[model samples]
Target: MALHWKLVIDTSDAPTLADFWAAALGYEVEDQSTLIDRLLAAGQLDDSVVTEHRGRRTFRGFAAIRHPDDPFDRDTGVGQGRRVLFQDVPEPKTVKNRLHIDVHAGAEGLAALVERLESLGATRIREFDKGPAGHWWVMRDPEGNEFCAAQ
Candidate 1:
């Protein structure tokens, strides 16, 4: 059987980073407001651990984004398929990522794709080009995590 999984990234600000990735990847930010409200009503959650973003309550240290077409729990807004979760951490990122996301540019081509990503708060770090092999750009998200924009 195939195992389920989601990528988890550590950030200083979960909500902001989640928003940036959601836009960059064309994913939807998970809405956990209903679950938050329910938990609060049952006293299973404390108000201090919650914060409002985009007018909805969410956990202060966690935020997530999921593929728009994927199945998710309506009551909890947790994705059952492709997803990424951002979590707040006290330590700063001091080294390169051991793993990274590679975003391929489709019909729009690399230039347009890079432009769109930049508009969404991604910064181009460097470019790579191999004669017949490939061409791509290294980019950093708002939080300085590395990812590739490939052609």
Candidate 2:
């Protein structure tokens, strides 16, 4: 069988990137605090590794989200379906992403989505063209990771 997995994006700020991708793809942010809670109870993660947000204890560096109704274990809240995991990195991003996501818009629409992404701080870098496959626009995230949105 083919291997199935989620693409983990390593970044300096997980929550910020997660929010950007959530709004960019219309995906909901996943809360995996039950796992965090368990770790905390077990003394695995020290208090310094966690932060308080809205009166809730949130781990500082990890956040995730998935499409609504995607399979996720209720006990731990890790996604078992379509997912993107954003994890924290200490150093700044110094180069482009070796692997990037290509968004398929497929002639349905582009202007609105691109405008929204720009408002969310994504930069529209360039447009790509193909004879039969058509076109897409390449963009860089705030951290300089490149992704393309095309139809």
Candidate 3:
């Protein structure tokens, strides 16, 4: 069996990053508020670690988005696979990303998708048309993380 994993990204503001990615990928932001509420009620967790986000309680230091079709814990809303976790970091992104997400927007949708992303705060970096490799546009998320929108 293949090992399961979720890509984790560091961000200065986890919720904002999570929101952007959720819209970008048509994913759902995981909701762990029920668990948080249970833990808080049982005195197993402190309010210090939680914060209000989008009108719900969420972990202050992290947030996540997952493919809507993927399996997830019903009670906690934690994805079982195919997810991206965003964790808070004190330092900002200072260099190019060594690993980046490449969004596959079919040839017909590439332009529109790129424009939608730009409207969501992604900045266009450049575009390339590799004769055999295909066409793509480089972009940076609101927080400066680089990714590609490709055909």
Highest TM-score among the candidates is held by which one?
1
Residue pairs with backbone overlap in model 1 = none
Residue 84 accuracy (lDDT) in model 3:
100
The weakest ten consecutive residues by lDDT in model 2 span 103-112
* Candidate 3 C-alpha lDDT tens digits along 18-87: 9999999999999999999999999999889999999999999899999999999988889998999999
Q: Give per-model TM-scores.
A: 0.98, 0.85, 0.97
Error of 2 at 51 (Å): 2.1
Clashes of each: 0, 2, 0
What's the TM for model 3? 0.97
lDDT (10s digit) by residue, model 2, range 1-151: 8566888999888888888898888787877678779999999889888875445566788778797877888877777888998888888888878999876663447776677778988999998779577877899877778998876
Go through the candidates in order and give each one's C-alpha lDDT. 0.96, 0.80, 0.94
Better by TM-score, candidate 3 or 2: 3
Model 3, residue pairs in steric clash: none
Cα-based RMSD of candidate 2? 2.2
State each model's C-alpha RMSD to the native: 0.7, 2.2, 1.0
Cα lDDT for residue 49, candidate 3: 98
For model 2, name the residue pairs that clash: 30-65, 106-151
The TM-score that candidate 1 achieves is 0.98
